[model samples]
Target: MTVAAISWSAANARRMERQFLLNPAKPGQAGPGEVVDAMLAAHAQVMSAAELSVGLRMDGATRLDVRDALWGEEPSLVKTYGPRGTIHFLPVSELPMWTGALSAVPGGPSPFKAGDRLTPSQTDEIVGAIGEALDGACLTIDELSDEVVARTGPWAGDLVLPAFQGMWPRWRSVMHVAGHRGVLCFAPNRGRKVTYTRPSAAGSEEPPLSAEVAAGRLVRRFLYAYGPATSPEFAKWAAAPARWAGEVFASLASAGEIEAVEMEGVPSSWVVAGDTEFPAEPVRGVRLLPYFDAYVIASHPRERLFPGRAYERALAGGQAGNFPVLLVDGIVAGVWHQRRSGRRITVTVEPLGSLNAGQERELEGQAERVGEVLEGWAELVVGPVAVGAHA
Candidate 1:
């Protein structure tokens, strides 16, 4: 059977516009819950970056709006450790699905085979202890660790490990582990210390969605947002074992939930069965996407999005989010950085090639939008379009 095809241009436009990156922010246009639900979750390692991520999509959204949606009373959003075990801002009501899907993911064995590390059983105990400790209240990691020790014996706190910041206690590692159980999520910051809380409207009972069920839904959700991908791509995105991702893909393909399509030069492309409608209008306008933007990460097959020399300059060590990028139409055309001085946000765009009058105009407008989101004036500085400087 000949699989249907989705062009690079079409796919880019549909996802950019649908993901709301091509539009202006309209404050309160969509409820806080709806904004995140559309993208599944926003990359939120840095709270400010996450705020900018949401602001670009909505109309005139202020930082406080993002905060209210998150760490607010009657919040419409929830903070949780999502795909790849990275912190993300998830829609509040979707905790069950996120938890169910993530919980099923095999974390694999501890990297260190032996030593002062958490045994499998001990790790699980920490997860359970976290849920119980934070059942209806917020607690700092240190505060919660004490309760975990009380619940699971001293083994829960004895395991100390090295991390990006420094040595991470067993209690700290399990924070995301507890997140997978759907009972625990991050609470608002209390002064300088981070805290954990139970998700609003979350039940203490067992997760309603099973691992198998959640895995299938996760596949569909990924394809719905970034489709025409292979099983391996899904695995990379979810941080799941390859064998498991293949099983999920097979199950979905058998159920007719997704179908295969032959992309131009690529093989084994599949999209949601009925989500093949291409954008009626081609994507226009320029966009200055921040580091770790969802659009940059969601797309599969780096070569298509970054193209030839564009990839090297935009990515560092083949990793995304190392540098902010310039997007003309739908492909990465250059790299840019911003510096804020008082009320002025000066954006320096270093393109890979010369731009026409129209692209320059659109880029300035895009820069202005960024300034608006930051509540500052925008100044555009177009430097020479150069690449391969390191080479």
Candidate 2:
């Protein structure tokens, strides 16, 4: 395969993340209006608050207008989903199916594993209290925990008081299960409330799609958006169990939606829908990617998406802290830091290697674009700092 094919595959793999992929115009190039148009054209219905910020920067969109345009008018433009139990934006139209697919698997474990302070009965009591307290009102986690304690008194004490640590994971799982069963649905937190609330009852219990069917749909979507991915990469991205992911791929292969490809000296299969095209030639530009950007996280085997040496430098010592990144010529060249002071924002970049004059200019331009999105004047600083320097 040509270098363009490899790059396209990598880009698509990143796009499969959907929420994490931000389609912004290159810096100093696309205007704010054009950026918003590009975002709309990408079929993004809802965007995460952070993802939206990055999107605006990438698209040269005015920072002030970002939230209002995408989420203010349509409150459902951004929300959360997934097994890791983190926040993500899903297009309103796709929420139901996505949630169904995500909630199919019971969350991994609760803090109250085998040995903990609370007994089984006590745990059940705590769960019941939370359910009762949140019956009609939306509450922040803190508020809910407080109410549970007030209501159950001694039992809540036994379950949450001492450390109140282990109870959180279990509670999250319970709430997830409740949401899956239609006992509750997520709504905007607003202020004073928590991350979600009980949404309307309509379309709540449409009967969850089977896991296999859901997996199939998820795989197809990933391949379409981030095709030419290895099974492990697909498994990681889908957050599906390995065996289940394997089975899903098998089913898709049987249906002829994917085909095998060779990478390095090994034979691997990736989704293929005939031929594809590269975005453009000489893909030279700078992009500021947000934390957990799909481009950085997708591709089960990360080596497929980034240079092995660069990955090591980016994630020094194995502690993958969320650091903003600087991408040059379609590859991650270094990491960036953004610090805000009053009306001014300072952007510091630590390059992994020497940058050409063109790359430097592109990086500065991207920083300016980020300033526009953030609605703050920005200063760009570049250096060859060590990987763990800032950390």
RMSD of each candidate? 3.1, 6.1
- The digit string of per-residue lDDT tens for model 2 on 237-317 reads 655577767776887878876665544434564655453443334444566664555445554345544565567776545
Q: Taking the tens digit of each residue's C-alpha lDDT, what string does model 1 give over 82-201?
A: 888888888876776788899888887666537766767877878888778888888997888888889988766665777778776666666777777776788888999998887753
Residue 165 CA error for candidate 2 (Å)? 7.8
Query: Who wins the lDDT comparison?
Result: 1
TM-score of 1: 0.91
**For this target, which candidate reaches the highest TM-score against the unseen true structure?**
1
Those runs of model 1 whose alpha carbons end farther than 4 Å from true positions after fitting are 24-29, 164-166, 201-208, 384-391
Q: Candidate 1: minimum summed lDDT over ten consecutive residues — where? A: 199-208
- Could you tell me how far off, in angstroms, the CA of residue 44 lies in candidate 2 after the best superposition? 15
What is each predicted model's overall lDDT from 0 to 1? Answer: 0.77, 0.53
